[model samples]
Target: MDDFDALSAMAERCFPGLETWNRDQIESQLKVFPEGQICIEIDGKLAASSSSLIMEYDAGLEWHNWKAISDSGYIRNHKPKGDTLYGIEMMVDPEFRGMKLSRRMYDARKDLCRRKNLSQIIIGGRIPGYHKHADKMSAREYIDSVLEKHNYDPVLTAQLSNGFIVRGLTPNYLPADGESCGYATYSAWTNLEYVAGAKRRFHHVIEPIRICVVQYQLRTIRKFEEFHQQCEFFMDTASDYKCDFVLFPELFTTQLLSLPSVDASRPGQAARQLAAFTPQYLDIFTEMAVKYNINVIGGSQFVVENDTLYNVAYLFRRDGSIGKQYKIHITPSERKWWGVSPGKKVEVFDTDCGPIAIQICYDIEFPELTRIATQKGAQIVFVPFNTDTRHGYLRVRYCAQARCIENHLYVAISGCTGNLPFVENSDIHYAQSGIFTPADAEFARDAIADECNPNVETLIIHDLDFEQLRRHRDQGSVQNWNDRKTDMYRVVYQEDEKTFEV
Candidate 1:
């Protein structure tokens, strides 16, 4: 409404004779409810505009035309506490039409619906391509043709892809709507995230993200079925608690070496034996993540790809997509006893909560690796570790704590607890899973959010507030990210593509 002139002009250009709003009409609507008026300006010029009003939804309501719903184009009958958002009009500059500005406007409308806790968004969408086939088919037949892929209507097709369902049709809705041929499709999109009794509310609180760490107990498995059930039990427990991400400890798959036929005497032989199950291992975790709709860091599994053994962590997304991050640094035992090769690259996975990086065991001890990951926009670092002694466990634990403080983000550590007496390389294990945070007043003073009792097989669940971490980074006692002396010293990866200037 503030840029009514620009919005009107753009609408006129986009739709020459198709019911463009004038100053008085726009002013009156804005006066009634200014919350529904939105305009986007790109480069000091108005590129798009969306106008809306609110109304109660009737389950058995008849199809409504634009004039009837808008109260003869004035929208004076808008209900302030309506449960549904009634889209009045949308306009985009001709120059920005093909740039997906309509989709952006639709996204904004859906967001507004959720913000207002509206039940759904209802709109009479114009079927612009109906006129071409008007003589042979009815409005309902035309919509069916478009749905069956026999014909297409640009407006209706785009709306359907944006989650709008065609409820009914109104013929001769707007007689002057030239492109639509006086026909409009009744479309509505329901907000599935809405709660039944929830009222319209606003909050700046970034939702608390919950994380679960699996203190996997090492034991011999007679069959892969047993391993699959064990994995599912942990994931189901975490998902029941509504944890966003579930993590497993490093080398947890080594328990498969306990099978009777596998030669588990030598470390190299055991790695090869585990590598044989890599395909089944991946399928199990990937399916688990998809079935449960949770992000899974399936620990570090040994893989023999192209005849080279590489220790890698697989991240499975809730959408059934998978990503792998290799251990960038290797230890002496890994190379000497297992013939393992180090990965030269690090990777990060993106989730709805935030971006995360997986640094396996020894790799977490290297501060530069975590630093690089944070520079690449990672908000959390997950360390899947395995240690045979308390000393080795402390090395990973202390370094992970330091990384969280230095990077100003959250860190989750998962490690194996029990010992595998029969398997050679997995003979002994000792660990405690813990979620770490920056050492700030707002966080746990000890930097440990939650931890399992030492040498116990358990699951540690903790809630991490990324918003609080962000606030700490912005105004905490010491801001490491902002206060870094990059001008004096910069750590650059040798194989990094970008050059660092210091």
Candidate 2:
């Protein structure tokens, strides 16, 4: 007991300005700050001590509450949170001075900051006295060395350290001996990114963004070469309209796939009739694009490649060259139309506007296909439709909207507008297409109104900014989608709907 008292007296001799608290006061403070303070007992006596508050605000002292107002918006999260301050108290017995118990106290405080999410620790660093103090080595230098060894950056200078910078200065008015050189405050904010990155951070985005978008109206539907003499009129109107690229519903001009007359005997005849439209359409689209500086989507139609038919869409760029004339991602439904081999790989191509992706009617229904496009950084996805019935039309539009939300991309779908008569019912379905955002997906869908009210086929055109998409990815709510923990539960698909490949 006497040795502990002697050690406390010795520590006071070392940190001369430290308050020489009576044992009763120290015990009282320690009781109140049980978790906040650490004490080293030597020979049944407290020899060294440290204490701190590990919170965003000054939760320890009443005087520190004033800082909370200064940093109101920060904790409120309205403004940028400034560096957090940890006022750590350290006292070491002079007998243990050679062992450097101050260094140990400083290390414990740093660990507190790390575990509690505090970025910095502020020190009421020693202020020089009027007369030279007898202490040869500075407690500041020792703390700096320890902090440096632990990889803490020196951001604040207190008193007179070259590497240290001052955050705040207090007026000199010491109640003890009435001595007061302004108390200099120094801080060391924690660096956590390096630690997190070293641990290998990964982002698991399960659902892709669904982008709903559309292109402008096209004007060349009347000149389908059905009347050869109308070619002059068609070209004139196309040029007058300044058509860069006009999307015609696939197979509409020739009525190819939906034709009742198509049979196995003369599949070659159907191929010839379709090829007849492309050369003329492509030439006009290519010329108009170069002249007017615009792009045109030649909607999905049968392409005869090596005697095997493939559903394809051509994107003609204004450079008189083409971009991403990708084969449509085919579904079983398309097999009946042209007996097309499904396009084997996903495709996204660069254009002046953005990376444009094309997915045919049925392809838009699959989320992974759209996810593949989103992951590849596709901004605008072009959807072209040919319908057999209204049975699946609503499903198609909903899937397109889902794609826009999940992928955060734009979708432009051109639907087959004209009526096709089959069976006893003249069933025709129209997809109301538009662009959707994370904020605006529901609004966009709500704006569609009832199509049964006899509205013209919807054509929505909007310049989708890439920045807004980035912001949505950064801070937007996941709407519970991102909460999916795919790593934990593994659900096996039934045989009818297995999505994984063997």
Worst ten-residue run, lDDT, model 1?
493-502
| Runs with alpha carbons beyond 4 Å of true place in candidate 2 | 1-223, 226-248, 253-268, 325-329, 420-429, 439-458, 479-502
Per-residue error (Å), model 2, residue 194? 38
lDDT measured at residue 202 in model 2 versus the true structure, 0 to 100: 28
How do the residues 282-335 of candidate 2 rate in per-residue lDDT, one tens digit apiece? 676676555434566656556666877766777777556775444545555445
Look at candidate 1 and give me any clashing residue pairs. Answer: none
- The local lDDT score (0 to 100) that residue 320 gets in candidate 2 is 64
Please write out the lDDT profile of model 1 over residues 61-155, one tens digit for every residue: 54466777887667898887888998878877987654456666787898888888888999888888987888898888999999888987768
Cα lDDT over the full model 1? 0.85
| Global lDDT of each candidate | 0.85, 0.48
Off by over 4 Å in 1: 1-81, 84-203, 496-502
